[model samples]
Target chain A: MRFTSLSGLALGLALSSTAAFAGEIVLNSDQSDPAPKKAMEELIANFQAANPGITVKWNNFDHEGYKSAINNFLKANPPDVAAWYAGNRMAPQVKAGLFEDVTDVWEKNGLNDQLKSAAPSMTIDGKKWGVPYTYYQWGIYYRPDVFKANGVNVPKNWAELVAACAKLKAAGIAPFAIGSSQKWPTGGWFDYMDLRVNGYQFHMDLTGGKVAWTDPKVKAVFDKWAELVKPGYYIENAAALDWQDAIPQFASGKAAMYLMGNFAVAPMMKAGLKEDQLDFMQFPEITAGIPMAEDAPTDTFHIPSGAKNKDDAKKFLAFVASADAQTKLNATLGQLPVNSGSAKPDDKFLKAGFAMLSSAAGLAQFFDRDAPAEMASAGMDGFQEFMVHPDHQDAILARLEAVRAKAYK
Target chain B: MSAIAAQPDAPLAASWWKRNQLQLAPWLFLAPGIFAFAVYVMIPIVQSVSLSFYEWDGLTPDAKWVGFGNYTELWTDPDFWTSLRNNVAWLVMYLLAVPAGLAVALFLNQNVTGIRVYKSLFFFPFVISQVVVGLMFRWFYAPNFGLLSGVIKTLTGSNIAILADDRYATYGIIAAGLWPQIAYCMILYLTGLNNINSEQVEAARMDGARGWKLLWNIILPQLAPATFIAVVVTVIGALRSFDLVSIMTKGGPYGSTRVLSYYMYEKALSEYGFRMGYGAAIAVVLFLIMMVFITYFILQMLRQERDA
Candidate 1:
C-alpha cells in the first residue's frame, strides 16, 4: 500500500513538471560539484526573485555523463536553457540547428561588451550561440621554493625555460609533472605550446584544420616541446597516471612545475602546499616577438533550438550574462568570471590569473574546445605518443596529418 | 432444433481447444519471450546493418545513404587494423587460461583436508565482479608504488609502468582477465570431475596405470564434455572482452591496447564519436567476426547432439 502511494506521488510530480505552464522555464546544466551546485541554486533563486512571475525548473547532471546527455536531450527533449562549452564544441550543435541563436539577446542586453573576452569563441558567422558565464586561465603552476633552491629564475622565453629545466634536472628533480592518462591535461600543455610557438592565429587555424599538421610550423612547435621531453624533464611514467595522481609528485617535491588550469590551484593547496611555496607564471614564450596568448576555456549557457519557452530562456540567458550574477556565481565557483565588468576575484591565484588574462593579446578556448571532438581526440593521443618518444616526431605528425584530412570533412 | 447447432460436429468444434491444448498452450507461453527477442536483439541487429550504409551524426534526422562508404574507409583505417590485431592476440593468449585452469583443477581434485575451504578460496576471483578485478590488477601493475613495479624497482633500480607502454599494456590487461577466467574454468572442471564414472577410474587404478597414463587414457576422455564447455565459454568471453579493456586502459596509450569491441565503442559511442554510420560499420564487422566462431561452435554442438 505504501509503495503504490509513494510511486503515485512520484508519478504525479513528474507529470506536473513535464506539463509546465507559460511562466516556467526548464533549465538543464552540469553543476554537480558541491560549490557549483550551491551557486546554481542561489543563482536560480535570485533569478526567480528578480522576475517574480517566471519560475525556473533546473535539471543538473554529473560532469562526464552531462557531455553525452546534452547531445541526446538537445535533439529529443530540449530544455529551455542548456549548459555547454564555447568554440568548436558548440559548432556541431549550431550547425545541426540544435542550439538557438541568442545574438539579439546579446545586442539588446549589451552582453557583447561585458562578455568581450569570450565573444570570439561564442560567435560563428557573426551570430552568438551561447552566453558564457565563467572560465579559468591555464598556465604554468610551479613550486617557487624549488625554483629558488635550484637557482633557477622563472622562465620568460623558450631558451630560458629550457635552461631552467636543465638546472632542475641536474638538481635531481623532474622539471615538469604531467599525467597523460585522461589526455585533457596534455591538451592544456599542447595549447600553450602551440600558442606560444606559432602564435594564436596559426594555432587556431591548425586546430580548425586550415593549416596542415605536416606544415613546418607545426613541426617547429613539436621541436620546441622536444627540448623538455628529450631531456627526461617530465616525471617518469606520466602516461599511466591521471592528472590528480601526478599532483602528489609536485606536492612531494618529486617534480617542480605543472602546466594546468587555475582549477588545479585548490587541489594543489589541498595536497599540502603553502601559498608562498606555490606560485603561478604565464606560460613562457616560444617564438620571438609573438604576442602572448593565454588559454581560457569558457563554460556557457545556450537556449536549445527545440525549446518550448524561447522567451523565458532568453531572459534567463540575459540574467546569467549580467555582471552581478557572474560575480557572485564565479566567487562560488572559485574561478574567473567571463564578464569583464564583474569585480576581481578575492583568491590570490585567481587574481594572478585575472591579471595575466587582462593583458593577453588574445584568449583561446583550449585545444579540446577549439578543435572538433574527433580531431581533439586524435590530436591528444598523438601528443601523448610524441611526449613519450620525441624521436617519433615525423611519424606522429604524419599520422595526425592523415587524421586531420578526414576529420575536417 | 436451432439448425442443430449448424452442424452435426458442433459439440466437437466447441471442444477444439482440448484437442490442441498441448501445442497451442506452449506457443501462448512463448509469445512474450519471442516478442522481446524480436524487439531487442534480432531487430536491432538488422537495423544496425542497414544503418551502416548511411552517414549520420547521431544528432540530426538527416542520414545520407552512402553504400560501402564506411566499409571502404575502415579498410584504410589504421586504428581498425590495430584493434583487429589486438583482438587476435587476445584470443590466442586467453586460450592459455584453459590449460592453466585444468592444471589447477587437477591438482585440487585429490582428497585432502579442509578441501572445501581451499576450493572456495580458489573460486573467490570468479565471484568478484569484473570491474573490481580490473581495478585491482590496474593498481597491481601501476608505476612508482604498485606491487610489480615496486618489486622491479627494488631489484633493478628501474620502474616500468606496464599499462603505460603500448607493447605491454594489452598483455597486462590479458593477465588480469585470466585471473578470473582461470578460476571459472577450474570450477567447470571441478564439477566435471564430480560426475566422472568412478568404476572406470577404479579399474584403471587397479591395473597399475597410476600416473599420467591413467589420467590421459581414462580421466581425460570422461572430461571431454567439460573441456568442450570450457572452450566455448572462453571463446565467447574472449570476443566479449570489452569490460576489462574499458576498465583497465580505456584503449589508451594512443589506442594501442584497443580490441574490436573497445574500438567499436570508441568509433561509435565515445565523446568524439557521434558518427553513427561509421560506428555501425565497426559493429557490423565485429558481429561478422563473431559469426565465424559462433557458426563453428553451433555446428559442433549440432553434431554432438545428433551423435547423442
Candidate 2:
C-alpha cells in the first residue's frame, strides 16, 4: 500500500510537467473582415507577448463555409477555441454537449455583469457557452444622390416610403436594389417586413414556433410586401445576383436604396461610393404604435468540450470580450462593439446607427441568426416566392405552415 | 488399373495449403481493394440510406423514425415536384449534346495545321470547375453588361436577363451546362473516330457517298460505343447538377432553378435545418429514377458481354 501511494504521487507529478509543456492553441474563426483580421492579429501578438509559454495559431473562413467546416472538424479534430453564432443557432451544438460551459468563467471574469443584455442568448439553461466579440445593426442603406435626384426624402412611415418608391420609378430609377439570388438577403426583407407589420414580440413568437405561420398578422405582412413587388419597383435583375453585386447599381445611381446591414459599407466603399453619398435609415414603420427594433447579430467565441488548451482558450475569449479588443475591432471593421465603453465611429450613418441601437428599448438578432436555421430557410424561400408572385400569398403561407410544422416537430 | 492404384503409395494426399492455394491467392490479391471500397463507398451510401428514415438534427441523440412519412410529405411538397420536373427537363435537354457532339466530332476529325489547338480549345470547358463555369455564365448573363445580353440587345433592341426571368432561368442554366457536356462528348467521339474502320469509309467514298448521307450510314454505326458512354455520362451529369445551380442561382428567382439534388441538399443541410428523413426520401426517389437507366445499361452491357 505504501509503495503504490508513492508511485501514484510520482505519476501525477510527471503528468503535470507534461501538461505544462503543452504547445500552441489552435483558434479557428469565421471573421474575414480585413479590419477585424488586422486587429485580431495585433491582439494575438499581444497575447503571445504576455504569455511566453503559450501561442495561438489562428485561421479564418467565410461565414457559411465556416459553419459546415466547424461542424465537420468537431466530429474529428476540434480546435481549442472557435467562433460561433449565438441564440437558437447555437442550441444544436449546446444540446449535443459539444461546447464547454463557461459559467464559472462568466462569473469569475465579471463578463456576466458586463454583458447582461447579451448573456441570455449565450446561456443555455443557466450556463454561459460563449463570449460575444462584436455585433452590428441591420437597416436600409440608400444612395442620397438618387433620392435627391428623384425629389424623395427619407420616409419615416410605410406610406411615404411607397410614395417615394413610386416617385423614383416615375423618374426611371429602381426604387430598391435587392438580390434574391442569395436566399438570405431576401430573408432580411422578410424579417424587416414582419417586424414592422407584427411588432417584435410576434416576430419572436413566430420564429420560436410558438405561433403558426398562417396567423393573420403574418399574412398581412406578406400582403404588404407583395404590394412592393406588384409594380416591379425593385431592380429588374434582382433575382440572379448577389447583394455585393447589386451595390454597383446603388453606387452608380441606377437604384436608390438597399436593405442591408452595416457590413455593406465595405462593399459600397469598394464600389467607390463615399460616406456622404451613402446613408441609412430604419425600415419604414408599418404598425402605427410599434417601436423600432434593430437587427443586431453578434459574433462570439467559444471553447469546445474536448479543447486541447482549456486555460488558453478561456484567456483568449476573455481577451476578445475586453474593451481594448472591442474598440480596436470596431475601429477597423466598422462593427458595433459589444463592450459598453468601446469607441463609436465618426461617420454620420454609423453614429446614427449607434445612437439608434444604444437607445433602443429592444434588440433582435438578424432573422436567420435569431430563428432556427430550418425555419429561416423555409421562411425565406416563401418570402422569395411571395415576392415573385404576390397573388400566391395563400399558397405561400400554406407552404410555410407545412415547413414550420415539420421543423418544429 | 493396378498401376494407377500403386501410385497412391507415392502421394496419398496433397498438403492443406496446396489444396486451398488458388482460392487463398485470389482473396489475398483482392483484400486491399475490397477493404478500401467497403470503407469509403459502400459504408457511406448505407449510412446515408439509414439516416434518411430518421428525424434527427444531426447532433441530437434521439432520432425518431418516420418511415415513409418523409416520402409521403415529399410527394405533396411543391418544391420537390418542381425540382423533379426541372431535373427531367434537364435530362431531356442535355441529351441534345450527344448528337451535337457527333456533328462537331465529324467536322473536326480531319488532320489540319493548328486544328489540334482548336479541338483543345473546344474541349477547355470540360476541364474547368463547375463553380468557374457558373460564374462565367453569370457574367455572360448579367443583363446590359453581359456579352450575350449585349449581343441580344443589339440584334433585337431588347435586353434579356436570362438568369433573372423565371421563364428562361432553367433553360439558361441548361445552356451553360451543355457547353461543357458537349465538349466532353466531342472528345469521346474524337477518340471513337480514331478507332473507326478506314476500309469502310474508303468503300463508302468510292460508292459516291458523302456529307450527311455518308456519315449517317457509315460513321454513326462505328461511333456507337462512344455515343453510349456519352449518353450515360450526360444523363448522370444532368441528374446530379447541383453545383452550378447552387453557385449561380441557389435555386432562386423563386426556386425555379431548383433540381432534385439541390432540393435534397436544401432539405437536409441548408439553413432549413436537417430534415434528414425527408432528404433521404428525396434521395430514394432520385435513386429509383436513376435505377431505370442503370438497369437498362446493365442489361445492355450483359448482352454485349455474352455476344463478345
Candidate 3:
C-alpha cells in the first residue's frame, strides 16, 4: 500500500506538469479579526510557497453570517478547510460526513498525546475530526478602582461575593452588568450558577440527558439567580441591550462587574478602558465541598470531506497544532493557548485567569456550547423570562422539559 | 389540402417551417424564463414538500418516509401554534398600510415647494434593507436610552422594554416591519393616483360630489389594482418575516417571538443537531399556509385577465 501510494503521488505530480491545475482550493473562516486574518494569510502564503503547484483562495465572514453561509456553501462550492465550533455544534455535520477524519495525521503529528483532554470533544466515537487552535476561560471581569474606592475586595466564596455585591450596592453602584437582550448572555449566568450550585458532573449529566431538567439541583440554581435579580444589583435596562453595548455602563462606573468571556476584553479596551483598571475572578463556590470548575470554549479547524487536497490540509493542521503556532495565534488574538507548554503573557489579569483555570478540577463548556442548540435557544429564553419574574419557576421548568424531550429525540 | 396541392409548383408553397413558426415562436421566447423559474423556484418548492414527509437530517444519504409525522408534530407543538397566531396578527394589522399609504400619498401629492423631496424622503424606508430597519427599531425600543422610551418616561414616568415583554414584543416588531411596508404601499398608490381619470373628477365636481363621496365614488375604484398588489405583497411579507425576529429577539423573552421560519432554522441548523426532517416538516406547514393565499390571488388575477 505504501509503495503504491508513493508511486501514485509521483505519477500525479508528473501528470500535473503536463496539465493545467484543476482550480483554487478555498479556505473559509468565521474569524473576522484583522490579526487572525493576517496570520492566516501568512500561513497560506507559506503553504503555497512550499507546494508550488497548488493555489489557495480565501473567504471570510463574521460569526452570524458565517453560520448561515456554511450550509449554502456546503451544497454549492464547499471549501477545503473551514473553521467551526466543536462538540454538539459540530456533531450534526460530522454525522452527515461533511468533515474528513484525520486520525492518522493526529497520531503522526503526536497531537493525540499533546491534546489528551481536548481530543475527546473533537472526536466522535473513536475518529478524530478536527484540529484545535485556541481556547479560553470565562469569568467575572471587575473594576479594581471601584473595589478600591468602595473598600471591597475580591470575594473567595459565595457568601463573600454576596456581601461584596451588597457593599457595592450601598455605594450606589450596580453590582452586576448583564445584558439579556441578546438572550445568550443570560445563558452564561445559568451555566455558572448550575455548575457552582450542583457540580461539573451534574451539569454534564443534565445536558447529556441522564438527569432531567426538573431535577432539584438545577432548580436551586434558578432560585439563587432569582434572589440576585430581586435585588437591584444588575444594571437597569439590561433587557434591551446587547452584551457589548452593556460595557458602557461598566466603563462609566455605573456598574462594578460583568460576567463575560475572554473575547470581551478587546471590546472593553475598544470602549476606552486600560488593562490595569480591570481584573477577573471565578464564580464563587455554591456547594461547600464541591470541586471548582471553569467554562472554556475553544475554537477549532476542520477539513471537509470534499477537500481536494487532503495531504496539504493535514500538513496545515499539523503546523497549526505546534506550540509555536498556538502561542503566536493566542498572543495575537488575546486568547489562551490550548498547547500545554506555550508561553503566556505577564499581565496580572491573564495570569490570575490562568491560575484559576489551571487549579480547576473540571471544565464546563459554556451553556450555549454545552447544550444542543435547540435546547439552548428554548432554555435561554426560559432563563430570561425567569429573570424578569422569578415566581414562574414551575412554568419555566415545564416548558424546558417539553423542549428538551423534543430536542434530545 | 387542395390549396397546398395547387400551390406545390407555385411560388407561394406553404413550407413546414412557416406553418409551425407561429406556434413555436411564443415558446422560444418563454423557454429561458420558464427554465430559470423551474430550476430556482418550482423544483425547490416540490423538494421541500416531499421532504416534509421524511425523517432525515440533511446530511444523511437516505431519507426515511414518515408520512405526516412532521405535520403531526407541528400540530402538537405549542410554539408552532404561537407562531401561527402571530402570523395571523401580522396579516390583519399589515393591511392598515393600504389606507395609511393612500393617506400619505394624497397628502404629499399636492403641488408645493420641495414636494418631490418630501415624496422621496417618505419613500426612504422601503429602500433600506429589513436588517437595518430591525436594528433601528431595536435602538428606538431600547428601554432607558431609546427615543420612544425617553418620550414616554417624560410624559408618564414609566419605561417599557418593548421587545422584552411578551405581550408587546411581536406588536412592536410588527410596527417596525410596517414602516417599510407602508412606504411600499404608498409608492404603488402614488403611481396609481397619477393615472386617475381627471374627467371623472371634473364631472363629479359639477354633480356636487365632493369630500368623502366624491373621492369614494370617483377615485377609489380606479386605485383597485394598486390596492390589490399592495395587499398581496403585505401578506407575503408578513408570512416571510424571519430576519427581524431572528435579529431583534431571536424568538426570545420566553419563546414568545418564535415564528415558524426561525423555529425551523433552529431545529435544522444551529447547535440543535441536524433534524432535517423536522425542519422540513415545519417548512411544509408554512408553505401550505402561504399556498392558500397564493391560490386565492391567482384565481382573482385569472378573473381579471379574462375580463381584460
Candidate 4:
C-alpha cells in the first residue's frame, strides 16, 4: 500500500499542470464578442492586480459552441472558474454535482445584500451555486420614429398594444420583428407573454414542470400571443431569419418594434439607427393587478467541482461580485450590474432598463434560462409552431404537455 | 532437418518465423487498418449500442440502465416519425442525381473548343466544401433578398421564404445537397466513359447502331460499374444528410427538416441535447436502415465477383 501510494503521488505530481499550481487559477468563459471579450480581459487584469502573486489564465470560447462544450470540459479538463448562466439553466450541472457550491462565498461577501436582485436565480435548494455579476433587461426595444410616422402611441396595456399592432400593420409596417431561426428569440417572446399574462409564479411553475402546459392559464398566455401573431402583426418568414437579421428590418423601418434584450441596442446602432430613433419600453400589462415581473437574464461565474485551486477561485468570485468591480465591468459590457451598490451606466437604454427593472415587482430569467433544457427546447419549438399556425394551438400545446410529462422524469 | 534443429547455433526464433511467415505476413500488413477500423468505428458502434440501453447525460459518472425504454420512446415520438419521413424524401429525391449526372457527363463528353474550361466549371460545386455549398444555397433561397426569391417575386408576385416554409425547407436543402452530389456522380461516369472500348463502339456504329439505340445497347452496359458506385455513394450521402440541414436551417422552423442523423445530434450532442440514450436509439434506427442497403450492395459485389 505504501509503494502504491508513493507511485500515485509521483504520478499526481507529474500530471499536475501549471494552472493547478499554488497562486494560479484557470478561467473558462465564452466572452468571445468584442465588448464582452474586452470586459473579461479587464476583469482578469484587475483580479490579478488586486491579488498580487496570483495569476489568471482565461480560455475564451465563442458563445454558441461553449454551451455544448462546457459539458465535456467541466468533467474532463475542468478549469478553476467557469462562466455560465444563472437560474434553471445551471440546475443540471448543480444537480449532477459538477458545480461547486459558492454559498460560503455569498455569505462571506454579504452578496445576499449587495446582489439581492439576482439572489433567487442564483439559489437552488436554499444554496447559491454561482455568483451573477451582470444581467440585461428583456423588453420592447423599438423605433419610436416609426411609431410616430404611423401616428401610433406607446402601448401600456393588452388592448392598446393590439391596437398599436393593427395601426402599424395598416401603415405597411410589421408590428414586431422577430428572427427566430435560433428559437431562443421566440423564448423571449414566450417569457414576456407568460410573465405579463399569468404573473411570475405561474410562469416559473409552468417552466419548472409543476404546471401542465394544457392548463387554462397557459392557454391564456398563448391566447394573448395569438392576438399579435394571428393579425399579421409580426414580420413574415421570421423562422428563417436569425435575431441579428431581424435588426435590419427594424433599423430600416420595415418593422417598428423588436421584443429583445438590451444587448440588441448596440447592433441597432450599428445598423445605423440613431439614439433618438432607438427606444426601450416595458412589455405592456396583460392581466390587471398582476405585479409586472420582468425578465432580467443574469450571467454568472462558478467554480467547477474538479477545480484544484478552490481558494483562488473563491477569491475571484468574491472580486467579481463586488460593487466596484461590477460597475467597471457593466460599464464596458453596456449592461446592468447585479450588485445594488454598483453605479448604473448612463447609456440611454441601460438607464431606462435599470429604472424599469428596479421598480418591477419581481424578475424571472428569460425562458431558455428559466426552464430545464429539455423543456425549454421543446417549449420554444412549440411557441414557434403556434406563431406560424395559430389554428394548431391545441396540437402544439398538447405536444408540449407530452414533452413536459416525459422531460421532468 | 532434425540434425539442423539439433545444432546448437540454429536459432529457435528464425525457424519459427520461417514456418509461419507466409500466413502471418498478410495479417501484419492488415494490422494497422484493422486496428484503426476497430478503434474509430467498431468500438463506438458497440458503445453506442450499449449506451442505448442506459440513460446518460454524456457528463454524469453514472448512467441509469433503462433497457428498451429509449427505443420505445422513439417509437411513439412524433419528431422521430417526421425525421424518418424526411429521410425517405431525401433518399428518393437524392437518387435523381445519378441520371442528372449521366446527362451532364454525356453532354460534356465531346471534342470541342474550350471543353476543359466548361468541364472544370461544371465540376466546380464538388470542388468546394459542403459548408460553402450550404451557405451559398442558404443565401440563394433567403426570403426577401435572395436571388431565387427575387425572381419568384417578379414572376408570381408573392414573397416566399423557402427555408422557413415546412413544405419547401426539406426540398430546398435536398436541392443544395444535390448540386455537389451530381458533380461527384458525373466525375465517376466521365471516368467510365473514357475506359469504354472505342473499337466496339465503331463496330456498332458500322452496323447502323446510332444515337439512343447505339448508346443504350453499347454504352450503358459498359458503364454499369460506375452506375453501381454512384448509386452506393448517393444512397450513403442521402442517409447521412446532416451538414446542409445543419448549416441552412439546423432542422428548424419547428424541426420540419430534421433527418435521423440531425435529430440524433439534437437529442445527443447539441446545445440543448443531453439524452445520450435517446440519441443512441435514433442512431440504431438509422444504422439498421443503412444496413439494409449496405447488405444489398455487398451481396451484389459478391455475386459480380462470382460471375468474374
Please give, for every candidate in the order listed, the TM-score of chain B alone compared with the true chain B: 0.94, 0.92, 0.92, 0.96
Tens-place lDDT digits, model 2, residues B1-308: 99999787556465456778898999999999999999997887787778778777666668898776777787788888899999999999999999988888888988899999999998999999989999999899888699999999999999888887778989999999999999999999999999999999999999999988888999889888898899999999999998889877878777889999998887777655466777877887888799898899889888978998
Q: What is the interface RMSD, in angstroms, for predicted model 1?
A: 1.3
Taking the tens digit of each residue's C-alpha lDDT, what string does model 4 give over B106-133? Answer: 9999999998899889999999999999
Q: Which stretches of candidate 3 lie over 4 Å from their true place?
A: A1-25, A34-56, B1-30, B269-273, B304-308
Evaluated at residue A317, the lDDT of candidate 4 is 99
Model 4, residue pairs in steric clash: none
DockQ of every model listed? 0.63, 0.58, 0.48, 0.70
The candidate 1 chain A region of ten consecutive residues with least summed lDDT is A14-23
For candidate 3, write residues B67-86 as lDDT tens digits. 99888888887778888888
- Best TM-score among the predictions, by candidate number: 4
Give a tens-digit lDDT track for model 1, residues A1-409: 9999999999998877654544799999999867789899999999988876789999999876788678888887999999999999999889889999899999999988998878988999899999999999999999999998879999988889999999899989999999998878888888988898889899889988999899999898899889889999899999999998999999999899999988788778888999898999999877889999999989999999999989988999999999999999989888998888898898988999999988998888989899998889889989998888899999888988988887887
Off by over 4 Å in 1: A1-27, A32-38, A48-60, A306-312, B1-5, B9-29, B110-113
Better of 1 and 4 by lDDT: 4
True contacts kept of 1: 0.71
Error of 4 at A351 (Å): 2.2
Q: What TM-score, over all chains together, does every model reach? A: 0.92, 0.92, 0.90, 0.95
How many pairs collide in each candidate, listed in order? 0, 3, 1, 0
State the TM-score for model 4.
0.95
By DockQ, who's the top model here?
Answer: 4
| Pairs with backbone N, CA or C atoms under 3 Å apart (clashes), candidate 2 | A373-B271, A374-B272, A374-B273
Interface RMSD of each: 1.3, 2.2, 2.7, 1.0
Ranking by TM-score: 4, 1, 2, 3
